[model samples]
Target: MIKENVNYKTLDLHQRDEWLHFVMKCETYDVFYLPQYVQMYEERGEGKAQLFVYERRAEEFVIYPFLKREIRGAAEGEVYYDITTSYGYGGPLYSLSRLKNDDDFVREFRAEFERYCKAEGIVSEFIRFHPYLETEAGLASYVNVTSVGELIYNDVTKTEEEIWSEVAPSKKRRIKKSKRNQVEVIFIDGKDIGPKEILIFYDIYTETMDKKQASSFYYFSLDFFQAYFTALKEYITLAFAMHEGRVISANLLLKSEGAVTIHLSASFKAYLHLCPNCNLRYECILWAKRNGYHIVDHGGGKEKDDSLYKYKQQFSNTQTNFHIGKKIHNQSIYNKLAKQKSKLVQGEQADFFPEYRQVLVTPRILSNK
Candidate 1:
């Protein structure tokens, strides 16, 4: 005996808000994913948000709110099935805790949702079943599970002097040397760059992507730039490292809560001699000091211990570990296949990382700092 309310479109927003608010209060709840975000996503003519819920009789349907979008026309901000996708801490926001039909409910919920996804052909990739969410059993049906790290700094408010002091002695020397070489570090926002100034940032970004042998989720998305600046300009910014008038390095940062999310970044190889990456990061940290943000999530890149991690760690000086979980559309099948493959070689899982997989390309992909 199960019941469900899947018609997000039919339900008035207040009802949805009430449901989401309750879910938001759950012990595992993260901040609301910004309701207007989903509206904005639809207004963009990119896709739609749908909800499919199953409630057991006597056991009320306790909705764990998730954002959803069809796979064919999915957009960047539009992820399907998020209990707390954007908030960086949205998994099972609340628990039924002790429902009599717990096991029966899980089965019904999974079956109905799987049928919904198949009928709708929703896009699991965009859903971003963050690596942290994989531990939840029910989520497996709606997402693709994989490993993703927050690439966060341990401390966001360490003093400037502290930032420098924490650097490996080797990196310390490099920064001192870069400043000596006459490299200029600029901290700016989108307004800092005239439209004409954009291409310069693109070239540097392309170079870094090429060197890393990887492509970010967003490469040259002007639309996303417009959305970011228009919707989140207050909390978003960019950092650029320049040598003379030429752009050599850049990093895009999103200011949220009390810290900055280092969304994306790139630099030139020839300029590696100057450590423009390190210098630009330092500038952003200082800017964050006066402006208000205190933390930085550089995001996961390559195998750890490379020059990139070292550069970010120099300023971060701390590590706050979090995983990016993913749930593919079909888990039972995939798990069975994975275990089969592992029997021959002990394979763990498959995912978008190791290749630096990303999905959003903001105009600020270049730096304003």
Candidate 2:
């Protein structure tokens, strides 16, 4: 049964502490649901963020953080609005204990939210669901939900020997060879990290993204990382691979509630042959295992069977599906803007939501690092 007098509220990114306080009340949640994580993109000028809160009673609330953008350059001054989840896992973080039936509540909440979007003339929405968290199944019926791919997970509950035994033979060889090559892994607390160390990580990360011809969205400013480290110091763990006193590779891990997510990683191009990245993962997994983390999530690759996925598979045998959800309101207007966008861009418009923004997706020939 649905509760009566359900109220809706919208809060901008500035009201972060209030929003996060609400998140902590939820029966289940993940670190990505934290406001600080979403603020990272907003602070970098990614888009205008609007945090939507749905309350059935004073005790129960669900929060969805959306980034809104105007579809520009379509016809003579015509514009359409589209929103998406910020980089990383995000969908809906709701109070499970507050609802009699989680699925029913989600459907009802989404219904009200759709009405709001339609009234505002917002065309569409996209979401990246949290892999480790539990979400209602019926959400797919309301939105275009599909398995993008699988994110790899390493079970930290196993003994160190058991964890090492599961590694792919090739990767095991690489790890041993990396040992012979003298790559050392070091963990730096975010609180202790300074501009010197920050620059080292930034240089390698940006250079790797540049080499892959990554999109502009991946080009985060140094200040963006600075704020992130400063804001989430307690949860962040930085791992660095050094060779002859030179930082050759680095990875960022976010720990919360007994799980560690392999947030980001990069390695020097010249050091790829030395297997610095392999060593980095090896060390991180060991650290997670010994530190009482229940799992280490190695996010998926560009594609299911891509070289990147193959490389991650060597570290863990457990796999979890990654899903992306999309929904469109105001279908008539959506069609109009999509048609205009198809004509504006070269070749056929990508099957992306709000086809007008198809230009955002660029061709990339991913190579192994």
Q: How many clashes show up per model? A: 37, 0
Mark the regions of model 2 whose C-alpha exceeds 4 Å error after superposition: 1-6, 73-80, 97-101, 343-350, 360-369
Q: What TM-score quantifies how close candidate 1 is to the native fold?
A: 0.59
Residue-wise lDDT of candidate 1 within 220-338, one digit each (tens)? 45554455445554445667777887778888776645656666688878878877766677666677776765555565545556666655665555664444445455333333434
lDDT of 2 by residue, 188-243 (tens): 98788877888887899998897889887677788887788888887788999989
**Reference-based TM-score of each model:** 0.59, 0.89
Q: Candidate 1 overall Cα lDDT vs. reference?
A: 0.50
Q: What is the lDDT of residue 308 in candidate 1?
A: 62
Model 1 residue runs over 4 Å out of place are 1-150, 191-193, 216-218, 221-231, 304-307, 326-369
